[model samples]
Structure formats: structure tokens, C-alpha cells
Target: MLVLFVLAFGLFAILNPRVFLNPINLQNMMVASPEVGILAIAMALAMLTGGIDLSLVAIANLSAITVSTMFTAIASSDPATAESLGGFIALIGVLVGALAGAVNGFLIATVGITPILATLATMQIFNGIAIVWTGGKTLYGAPAVLSSVGQATVGGIPILFLEFLVVAVLIGVLISRTPFGRRTQLQGANPTAAMYSGIRSTSVLYGTYVTTGLLGGIAGLVFLSRNPTASADYGTSYVLLVIVIAVLGGTNPTGGFATITGVVLATLVLQVVQSGFTAIRLSAYEYAIAQGVILIAVMVFDQVRVRRRPRRAPSSQTETIALAEIPRA
Candidate 1:
């Protein structure tokens, strides 16, 4: 229904004067999707694990700086510099992302730290490291080959979108088909019961964090390629958006469970909604307000549904008491 409204308005406005489906603007929307979408996937996974990643934007910015700087240094004209290092540096960045994910997992699972506090602290630390690494400098002159990931297309679809498809599928398998995923649901359902079942709940919890980190890293690289510039302030706006997508997709914050398709659908809705704000001349603050209102409304609705849902048949004791009162019959 909301999507219908946006489409109707866009169509009416286009008919009246403006052309809404400009190829260039849609392409711009596609380009922007990967950065936010990747973070949203990561955030969704973290939420499924009964946690959140407040440091996702930081992770993306930190990884972006690292990848861009390395690309700059390796692609330099000097002979002693690393040769053809675009692929190598990018690969290393990917692994480092997994490691960062593990760190998040360890903190929350083993160190008894809350996800919010741990991630918040790590967000500052990672962003600070990124700033210090460049000493407030921006990286330029990224290798042409590296930029192709953002600029290239296959069958008229953006490579970033393709990459996101691959990641999303991999995540879907992990959450939907794997034993770890089942155990993760159990953990979210009840930590004590999951532990008693020998599910090694800690491992599953750590895995969630590590996966979030890994996705954040990939998102950073994708962001760097699109902009082809490195800065300490990359991906900040995505933090709330990541959560928005997760919640809109129907992932429970109180428990770590979600579906890939739902998230994909939510992504489309958010993209359209955001585009609507732009089309409607909403200010940045107004857009933020709109997003907040949407999320709060949806969350409340879900809560109400949960409350009104009927549990299994009434307790056995009530049935026994009722039967005794009617024994004469």
C-alpha cells in the first residue's frame, strides 16, 4: 500500500511535468544500494543473533580507508611498490573483516560485554584508527581495475548488485539451511536451554558477530569503489538505515531470526521510500523524521501482534479443576 502511494504520486508528478524514471537517476539509486544494502544485511544478521552492530558504519569507513590507501600505495609508479596489488589488498581486507567479526563475537559471547556497549566502543576505536592512519588525508588515484567493480555491468545490471546477490545467497544458506542457524534460533529462544542442549551457544553467538564484520568489510570496499575516494567519514548515514532495513524486513530485535527474501523486499521498500523523500523535496531532517515514524509504527504493530497471539491450550491444572466441578454430570 505504501509502495503504491509512492508510485502513484511519482506517476502523477511525471505526467504533470517531471520525468520520474530517468535512467541516470535510477542508475544512481542502484549505485547507492550496495553500500546501504550490504550494511543492512550485516545488521540483519546481528539482529538475528539477538544483538546489534552499532559499529557497522565505522567498520565500513575503516575498511574503506585501509583498502584505498593500500590500493594507492601499491598502484604507485615506484618499482619497489607492490605490483598488481589490487586483488591482493582487497582479499586481505576481506579476511580482516572476518577477523573483526570474530572480535565482535568474542566480546559479546566470551567477555560478557553487551553488544551495544561493545560495538559502540569499537565503533569509535575503528573510526579513530582510520582517521589516524591517514592523518586526516584522503586517498586518491585508485587503480582502474579496482574501480571497475563499481562501474562495470553484466547484462545491464550493476556488478555491485550482483555481488550483493552472491553475499545474500551465502547468508541465506547460513541462516536457513545450516545447523549453526538452527542453534542460533535456539540461542535466541532461550540461552539456558540452548546451552543445556550442548549446542555450543557461544560459538553460534561469535559466528554472528564475525559474519557481521565480514559483511561490513565487503560493504566498505564496495563503497570505496563507487566513490573511488577514501575518507574517514564514509557510511555514517547507513547506521540507522541498516537497522531500519532489518526491522522493516521482520527481523526480531528481541531474538536473532530473519529471512533473506524478507530483507530484500524491505530493501526495495526503503529505496523507494527514500527516493520518494527526494522526489517530494523533503529536507534531510524531514527524511529522518519519516524513517523514525515508519520504524516506530511497524515495531509497535509487531508488539501488538505478539501480545494478542494466543498461546497453546490453557494449563492442565485449569482443565482438571473445571472437570472436577462438573463431575456430577
Candidate 2:
């Protein structure tokens, strides 16, 4: 991933040095990356558990719509009160995302529905709710403070980009330092073994989806802050883009592996490619075609790497052998 990022950056720098290397263009990439970067993190989390959350973008839209509507309504009646409670309202928006996640968790963990199917149904349901709430129109305006913070900068770094970094670091720590993260990976790798080892697969799955939901919610808030508008159909293409980011970031689509660092690097790579495309005046369709090609190439490379790699004894077999070697207690 690092190599890919460096190569992409260098190539773009060579092709469009003036525009690609411009400070303004770089800042734009930083600002634009968070919405998709954060969502990519969420998607990576789901993939870590051998599941996918197709409703993530829907959850984000719903959360953003909820926030936008509340802010607009409150600000319309009592601007002072709305200003005072802007933070609270934003928190509520994030909670809305968590609630949506809980719904997905329930359907998958409690109801035993397939992850894809459950999330697909909920995606429509969530989007439908957003449309009904907004009458299929865009809800514009957010707290002045929120928008300011979203667009703020410090030492040439975008506040939104900083937030994305914080999120990525925190998630990286959670996966690397926490027992739940270990359990999640284990569950994805071998559900039966995780069960035998007393891991509550259902709870893990539920928590996984909820966490992803929460992340989605955060992404939604960021989206609303950056754009100051919400609609049921906003970021409709992000679903696939995030998946591509996750996969390119070294996340296993089938589960049991993910890397926050890889995801971050992949995000940068895509951002550079995108900004480069714009600099070179490539059409959106061409950019999309490039994305598809990148995804396919990465998948093929991963397949080859896995195939050429030596397989190790299954952990279960290794554990059994070790247990057999031990004396009776």
C-alpha cells in the first residue's frame, strides 16, 4: 500500500506537477478525503468480521438528515437556543447512526439474516425514511459553528482531515490493543472455533455492526458539516467506492483481516488518483473506470500472493496437538 501510494503520488506529480503539487489542491484532497475515509474505516470493520454493511451510506444520510432537520427547525424558532445546543444536536445525529447500526445488528445477529441481505433491506428502509422526512428534497443549513469547524484549518492541515486521522488511530488501537478486536478477528476466521473457545459470536457481530454504524454516523456528520446539506441520495456512489478503499487497504473481503494504516494509505492513493484525474481533465466515467481497474488488479494480486504463500497448520489442529502434549491436570 505504501509503495502504491508513493508511486501514485510520484506519477501524478510528474503528470501534473503544478496542479497536483499545489498547496490548494493538496488541501482540497485532505478536506475531501475524510467523508469517504471515515466510511472506508467503517466498511473495513465490517469486513473484519466477515460481514458487510451496505446500509452504511444510508445510515450516514439518515444521520445527516436528522441533524440538518433538527438544526434548521431549532434555528428557525430560536437561533440562540439552536446555537447553544449545536454540539448536542450533532451528538444526537451520531446517535441516530448508532441506532441504525443497532437495527442492522439485530437483523443479522439476533434474527440470523445474512449480512448482505439484512443491510440491503435496511439500506432501502433507511433511505426511505430519509426521503419521507425530507419529502425527497434537500435539507440545507447546519450550525454555523459546525460548518466552521468542518472547514477549519491549522498549520496547513484541515480540521476534518485531522478528525479522520484521530478516528483512524483510535480504531487502529482498538483493533490492536483490545480483546474485542481479537475476538472479532477470531470469529471471522473460524466461527466454530471461536464458539468452542467461549467467544460470543453473536455479541461480537452485534458490536461490530454497531461500531460500524457509529462510524457511519460520524461520517454523516462530517458530510453534513462539509456540504451543509443533506439528501436521501447524497453520496450514492460511496457504497462501492468505500468497498474499493477497504479492499485496497488490505482488508480481507471474506473477513478475518484488516489494517487501519493500509486503509489510510489506500485513501490517500485514491485521493491522489482522483485529484490527478481532475488535473488531467479525465471524465468522471474514466475516473470510475480507473477505480474498477484498480480494484480488479488489487484482487488479482492478492489472489496470487495468497496462492504462492505456504499454508500453515490450522490453529485448531495446532491447539489440539499442544493440548495432547500436556500432562493431565
Candidate 3:
């Protein structure tokens, strides 16, 4: 996937060096990516546990909407009061996300609902709440600090991109090094075996969902910062896009395997394609079609790979030993 991303980028750069390789264009690509990229990582985490978070985008929008509403209300009466509490408002958004995630965890983990059905139901619920909160309108005029966070750069790197990078590293370490991550993999691979081994499956599931919610909330913050607006329907297309990116990044649909590195590379690849399409004046529908095709192709390839893998055969010595241990007729 990394090689594919590199090749695709090189091809684009070759085809239109004036735009594709232009510094401003490259920066724009990076800046536009963090929202979807962050959501993709969150999706990957859920998929690693043999579950899918269909409500992630909804959660993000809800979180952002909640915070933005408060900011707007305060700013209308006291702009200085709102400005002084920018960081606090952002934290509240994240907490709301966490609370939303906990709801999902309770439903799927504690209540024993199927993950897909549970998250699907929550997605609508969250989205509805957001729409109701804002009367289907957009909220803007946040603090200047948020605007700076959204647009500021250090050493030419967008702060949002830096946040994404930091999250990627943290999640990578969590999945690759932590006990909870190990248990998640084990549970996904074989829930019965993991339970029998004394792993707290409930804790693992709850933790995974909560972590996903946290990521979604953080992504919401960045999204709102970038646009300085919160809308109930913002990023509606991202739900499917993040899932596609997660699958393409080597997060198994059946669970038990995932790679943050693959997720990052795949995100870059898609972003490159998206940027190129934009440069050529492609419509949003075209982008959706491209994503749908990519998703189908990746799923088909995964099925083919699984089918082609050789099954383990018993060794001659093991077979003989088994035969010897059998009771005499």
C-alpha cells in the first residue's frame, strides 16, 4: 500500500508537476486530510475488534455542534467570555464524544447487541440530536484561538496534520504494545478462547469503543477549527469513506488484524486522488463512485487472498502419534 501510494503520487506529480508538486497544493492536501484521516484511524480501531463504527461521523458532528452552540451563545452576549474559554469548550466537545461512545459501549458490550445494529441505531440518534440542537442550521464564529489552531502552521506543517500524526503514533503504540490491545486482538480472533483464557472481553470492548469516540471527538474539534463552523450534516460522506480507507489499510473485516501504517498510507493515496480530481474539476459524485469501486475491489481481493491461503496439514509424526493413542477396536 505504501508503494502504491508512492507510485500514485509520483504518477500525479509527473502528469501535472505544475499543480501536483506545487508547494501550496501539497499543503492543501495535507490540511484537507486530517479530518478523514483521523476518522479512518478511529474506524480501523473498531474494525480491529471485529466491529464497525457506523456512527463515527455522526458522533463527530454532534460533538462539534454541541461545543459550537455553546460558543455561539456566549459570543452573542459576551464575545470576550467566549474567547477566554475556547480550550474549555473544545474539551467539552471531546467529553461529549466520550459520553456518546460510552453509550455505544453499553449497548454493544453490556447489552449484548450486535455491533453493527447497535452503532447503526446510535448513528441516527446522534445525528438527530445534532439537527435538533441547531435546528438544522450551521454554527460558526468561534474564538480566534480555534481559528489559529485550524489554520496555523509551524515549519510549514499544518497544526491539524500534526495532531493527526500525534494521534497515529499514540494509537499505534496502544495497539502494538498495550495489554488491552492484545486482548482486543485475541477477542476478535476468537472471543470464546479469549474469554476462556480469563481476558475481560467486556472491558476490552468498552475500552475500544470509548477510544474510538475520543478520536471522533478530537477529529470533530479539528473539523470545526478548519471551517470554524458546525453543521449536523457535515462530513456525511465520511462514514463510508473512512470504512473504505480502513479496509484498504489492511484492517480485516473479520477482525484480529490492523495496521496504522497502512491506514496512513492509504489515506494519503486517496487524498492524492481526491486532490487530482479537484484540480480537474471532478464532481463530488465522481469521488463517491471512485470510493465505492475501491471498496469493492479491496473486499474482493481480501476474499481471494483468504481463499488462496494454504490450510495447515498434519505432520506425519503427529498423525502417527494420534493414531497410536487411539483406543484399540
Candidate 4:
């Protein structure tokens, strides 16, 4: 993120000169961070458990579509209905997200499947449901108040940023300060050891998946609120971004590691680069190349770190010296 920050401001100030660091652009960055940020946290936690949640982007898409669809349905009957039902709409979103997450947890834990395969199956499944719901229609008739949450702010900061902040802080505290969090790390680090030590590995694993699913649902709402429109194609391109944010932010895929703050920083980096791409007139497709490159680099570094920490092999040069110095035994 620091790199992207520097790259964004440096290049933009040099070229655009008048507006790169302006509050407007800064606000835009913050407003844009939530959807990815929310999903990034979920992805980070899931990856920290030695698993992945490919279904999140799909779930997010579903949530966004749900928000838009609900708003349209409610307001279509009586446009003023938003004033009355806005709170209920938000509540429904939370419930839907939580329920989806629980399903994810059950499939991974009790069903005994690899998370990658499990989530992959549901990724398509949930996405398919979103498509069927939308029937290939774009939802644009959102209630005005519901849409405001996306771009609204207080004291010069976007409310969406605050929403993301709340999630980050709440969950960060849960993971860093609580016993459940420690046990999660333990399970991720050494499942056999954690199990032998009487940790409920299945329950923890279930918790992890459900948490991912629930967060993904919330992420979906954020995406929908901000865009205030939905199509079947929602978040289809975001799966890689989700993984990139988590890994770049210092979450270990092999388990027992995560840094929520790092994930936030990583999201900033991506947004910065994305803003730069926008200013430089690069098509969105071009930025996909950038995302791909970063993913490969992050994955390589993570694998190297895991292997280096555990291998503990003597260097070839050190082994040669030991052989040479051996006594006549």
C-alpha cells in the first residue's frame, strides 16, 4: 500500500499536478475500499486457517443483487417505503450473510472436504442463484436513502470507510485478544497437535468457514449499496483481488497467521494502483495483468517463507566443511 500510495501520489501529482492529493480523490479512495476491504478480511481469516473461500465474491455479488432487488421490490410498491423499511433491509442483509456463512462452515467441517473444492463448488452455486434471481436484468431502482450509505460521510470521512473500520476492529480484536482466536491459529498451525490437545478442530474449522461466509455476505451488501445497481456479473472479477489482498496483507495460507492491519494496508495499495491505472487511462483489463503479477509474487514469497521456516536444512557449503573436518572415525 505504501508503494502504491507513493506510486499513485507521485505519478498523479507529477502529471495532474492540481488534484492528485485533493480531498475529493482521497475520499474516492476511501469510499472505494470497503467492498474489497470487507471481503479481504474474510479472505484473510479463512486463509489463516489453511483454507480458502472462493465463494465470497459470489456471495458478495449475491448480496449486492439482493440489496438492489429488495430495494426495488419494496419501493416499487410504494416509493416512500424506503423511509419505513430501510432498517429492515439492512437487517435482512445481515441475516442472509450469516446464514450463508453457516452453510459454508457446515460443508467444510462436517462434510470433510477441502475448502478449495468446497468453496469452488458453492462459488458457482451461489453465483448461479444470483443469475436466476436477476434473470439477466440490471437493478437500478434503488431507494435514495439506501444508496446514500455508499457515498455518505461524517466529518470528512466516508461512512463506508467507518463500516469497514468497525468490521476490522471488531474482528481484529476477536482474533488477536481472544482464546478462540488463539485456538484458531493453533488448529491452523498443527491440526493433529491441536486435536490431540483437545481443541475442537472441527468446531474451529466450522467457525472459520462460517465467518468467511458471513463476512462475504456483508461484503455483498457494501458492494450493492455503493453501486446501487446489480447485474449477474457482480464481483466476478474479484476473486483474485480477494486472495491478493489477504496474502499481500501478511496472512499465511498454511495457517496460524494473519494481520488485519496489513490487509487494510494491502487494500490501500490495490486501490492506489487502481486509481493510478484510471488516471493513466489504462483499461480495467490492463489492471488485471497487474493483479495477476502481484498474486504470483505474493504466493511465491509465502511458499518460500513456509518452507524456509520448517526445513532447517544445513547449507551445502556447511555440510562440505563438516565432512572435511571429520576425525578418523
Candidate 5:
């Protein structure tokens, strides 16, 4: 993933040195990346559990819509009040995201629904709810302070981008340093073994989906920060794009492994590619085609690498004999 990011960045820099390398354009990329990057992280978490959350974008939009509507309804003309209320409302948006995630978690963990099917169904349901709430129209207006924070920069780095980095780092630490993370990977790697080891699969899965949903909600808030408008249909194309980012980031679809670093680098790679496309005047369709090619190539590469690696031998002679004695299929 790091190699891919470097190569993509170098290629784009070579192709459009003046535009792609410009400070403003680079800043724009940093600003634009968080929305999708957060979603990609959410998707990665789901993928880590041998599952997927198709409803994440829906959850994000729902959260954003909820935030927007609340702001429009209660916003004060007074700047200070509006700003304070906006901060409160934004927290509500994040909580709304967590609530939405809890719903997905319930359906999957409590109801025994497959993650993909459950999220697919909830995606539509969430979108429907958002549409009904907004009458199928975009809700505009957010707190001035929220927009200011969204566009604010410190030491030339976008605050929004810095927020994304913090999120990524925190999640990375969670995965690498926490017991829940260990259980999550173990559950994905082998559910039966994890069960025998006393890791409750249902609990882990529920927590995983809830966390993803929370991340989705955060992404929605980031979206609002950048563009203070919300609609049920916002970021409709992000569903597949985020999945691509997760897969390209070295997440296993069959579960058991994921890397936050990989996901972040992959996010940057896609961002650079998209920026390059705009620099060279390529159409969106062309960019989509390029994404497809990249996904396919990465899958093929992973397959080849897996096949070439040495497999572990049986640790005990008795186990080897048992394997040798087994009937041929």
C-alpha cells in the first residue's frame, strides 16, 4: 500500500507538476480526503470481521440530515448562541450515527442476519427515513462556527485533515493495543476457535458494526463541515468507492486481518489519483474505470502472493500421521 501510494503520488506529480503539486491543490486534497477516508476506515472495520456495512453511507447522510434539520429549526440569529448550539448539534449528529450503528448491530448480532444483507436492507430503510424527514429535498444551513471549524487551518494543515489523522491513529491503536481488537481479529480468523476461547462472537460483531456506524456518523459531520448541506442522496457513489479503498488497503474480505496504516495510505492513493484525473481533465467515468482496474489488480496480486507463500507444517508427528491417514477426497 505504501509503495502504491508513493507511485501514484509520483506519477501524478510528474503528469501535472504545476497543478497537482500546487500548495492549494494539495490542501484541497487534504480537505476532500476526510469524508471518504473516514468512510473507508468504517468499511475497513467491517471487512475485518468478515462482513460489510452497505448502510454506512446511508447512516452518514441520515446523521448529516438530522444535524442540518436541527440547525435550521433551532438556529439562533445570535452568532454566539448559534455557534454553541451548533457544537451541541454536531455532537448530536455523532450520536445519531452511533444510534444508527446500533440498529445495524442489532440486526446482525441479535437477529442473526448476515452483515451484508442486513446492512443492505437497512441502507434502504435509513435512506427512506431521511427522505421522509426532509421531503426529498436538501436541507441547508449549519452553524457558522461549524463551517469555520471545517475550513480552519493550523500551521497550514487543514483541521479537518488533522481530525481524520487523529481518528485513524486512535482506531489503529484500538486495533493493535486493545483486547477487543484482539478478539475481533480472532473471531474473524476463526469463529469456532474464538468461541472455544470464550470470545463471544455476537458481542464482538455487534461492537464492530456499532463502531463502524459511529465512524460513518463522524464522516457525515465532516461532510457537513465541508459542505453544510444534507440530503438523503448525498455521496451516493461513495458506497462502492469506500469498499474499494478497504480492499485495496489489504483488508481481507474473508476476515482475520486489517491494517489502519494500509487503509490511510490507500485513501491517499485514491485521493491522488482522483486529483490527477481532474488535473488531466479526465471524465468521472474514466476515473471509475481506473478504480475498477486498480481493485482487480490488487486482488490478483494478493492472490498470487498468498499462493507463493509457504504453508505451515503440522507441529506434531501424530497430527501429521492423522492427516496422512485421512481418506482422500
Candidate 6:
């Protein structure tokens, strides 16, 4: 998939070097990628555990909005305290996200609710809370320090992109190299076997959702920093997009299989395609349509492939009789 993406990107750059290959355009593409990329990774984790998180973007928005409101209130009351809080705003956003994830975990793990229904309900609840808190208005004027992460560059690389890279590496290690990751895979692949093996399935599920929430929160904070504004309706279409990315990156929808490398590379491909569309002056709706088509096609292909696999039949009477005769001889 990465190879295909590289080929497509090369073709585009060759076709329109002035636009697609331009340094500024590349930097802008990187800047645009991190939020969705981060969310996609978070979504990948959930899928690996045989579940989905429909509320990630909602969590992100709520966290960012909450932190933004806190900062605004503090700044209005005491300049010095607000200044100190600015540095801690990101951490506070992550905590908010983790708390939201805990709610999801409790509902699904403790209350015995299905993951899909649980997250679906939470999605609406979180979105409603955000709307009520923000009163359907956008909050702006975050601290300059927080904004710098989105605006500043290191060695011509966007800091947001760098942050994403760090996160991807950490998550990749967690999923591919850690014992916890192995347990998660086992739980997703065969819950009965995992439980029988003394694996605490409930704990794994809780951890997975919480980690997802943390990532969502970080992405939300990044979005807030990038735009320096908080809105209740931010990234309204991202939940589906992240799901598509995760599936495309080889995170099995049925669970028990995923690759962080695939997720990161897939994100780059999408971002490149997005930038390519802009270079050629394509409409934004076209991008959404293309993504939808790709997602549907991939799902269809997976279903077909699964259905095409050979099936094993039960033992026939002739084979059973032959085996019985041999044993008697």
C-alpha cells in the first residue's frame, strides 16, 4: 500500500511539479495530516480490540473546548495563572479525554453494553455536552505558547507532524512489541480462549478504550492549537474518515489484526491525495466521495476474500470406516 501511495504521489508530483512538489504545499499537507492521522491511529487501536470508537472526535472536541474555556476563564481573572496554565493545557486536555474514555469503558466493560452501541450513545452525549457548553459558538484566543506548536516549525518540519511521529512510534511499539499488545490481540481474536487462559479481558478492553481516548484528546488539542479555536462541531466528518483509514491500513474490522506502519503510511497516502486534489483545484466534496468509494470497495473486497477461502468438511463415512478397519487390523 505504501508503495502504491508513493507511485501515485510521484505521478502527481511529476504532472504538476510547481504545485504538488512545492515546499510550501508539502508543509501544508503535513500540517493538515496530523489530526486525522492521530485519530486514525486511535481508531486502529479500538478496531484491534474488536471494537470501534465512534466518539473519538467528540471526545477531542469536548476536551479542547473544555480546556479552551478553562484557559479563557483563568486569563480573564489572573494573567499570571493563565500564563502558567497555558503550558499545562495539553495535559489537561488529555486528562479530559481519558475521563471520557473511562465512561465508555465502564459502559461497555462493566455494564455489558455492546461496544458499537455504547460508543454510539456516548458520541451523541459528548457532542451534546460540547454544544451546550460552547452554546454553539467558537472559542478563540488560546495562549501564544500553545499556538506555537501548530505554527512553528523545526528544521522546516511542522511540529504537529513531529508530535504525530512520536505518537505513532510509541503506539506501534505498544501494539507490536509489548506483552499488553499480545494480550489485546488474543482477546480480540478469541475472547473465549483468552478468558480461559486467565487473561483479564475486561481490563484489556478498558485499557484499549482509555488509550484511544487519550489519543483523541491529544489530537483535539493539536487541532485547537492549529486553528487556535474551539468549536463544538469541529471535524464532524472525521469519525468515518478515521474508520476508513484504519481499515485501509489493515486493521481488521472483525478484530485481531493491525499494523501501525500500515496506518501511518495510509495516512500519508490520504494526505498526499488530498493535497494533489487541491493542487488541481478539485472540489472538496470530490475528496469525500472518493474516500467513501474506496472504503466501500475495500470492505467488499475483504468480504469476498473471506468468503472465497476453502472450507473443511466433516469426516465422511468411507474415511471413518477405513480408519476403523485399520485400527482393528
Index of the highest-TM-score prediction: 2
| Model 3 poorest 10 in a row by lDDT | 290-299
Q: How high is the lDDT of residue 299 in model 3? A: 76
Q: Residue-pair clashes per candidate, as listed? A: 4, 0, 0, 0, 0, 0
Sort by lDDT, top down from the best: 2, 5, 3, 6, 4, 1
- Candidate 6, residues 107-191: lDDT per residue as tens digits? 9889989999999999999999999998999998676777888988999999999999999999999998998999999988988
lDDT (C-alpha) at residue 34 in model 4: 90
Output the TM-score of candidate 5.
0.93
TM-score of 2: 0.94
lDDT of 4: 0.81
User: Candidate 3: deviation at residue 291, Å?
Assistant: 2.2
lDDT of 3 by residue, 123-185 (tens): 999999998888999887666777898888989989888888999999999999999889999
Superposed on all Cα atoms, model 6 deviates from the true structure by an RMSD in Å of 4.2
Q: What is candidate 2's CA lDDT for residue 246?
A: 96
Which wins on TM-score, candidate 3 or candidate 4? 3
Give per-residue CA lDDT, model 2, range 141-168, as digits (tens). 8877779988789999999999999999
What is the C-alpha local distance difference test score of candidate 5? 0.90
Q: Is candidate 3 or 5 superior in TM-score?
A: 5
- The lDDT per prediction is 0.77, 0.93, 0.89, 0.81, 0.90, 0.89
Query: In model 5, what is the error at residue 121, expressed in angstroms?
Result: 0.8
Give me the runs in candidate 2 sitting further than 4 Å from their true place: 310-329
Please report the candidate that would top lDDT against the real structure: 2
Task: Give the TM-score (vs. native) of candidate 6.
Answer: 0.90
Q: TM-score for every candidate vs. truth?
A: 0.86, 0.94, 0.92, 0.85, 0.93, 0.90
- Estimate, for each residue in 97-194, the C-alpha lDDT of model 5 and write its tens digit: 99989998899889999999999999999999999999999889887767897899999999999999999999999888999999999988898999
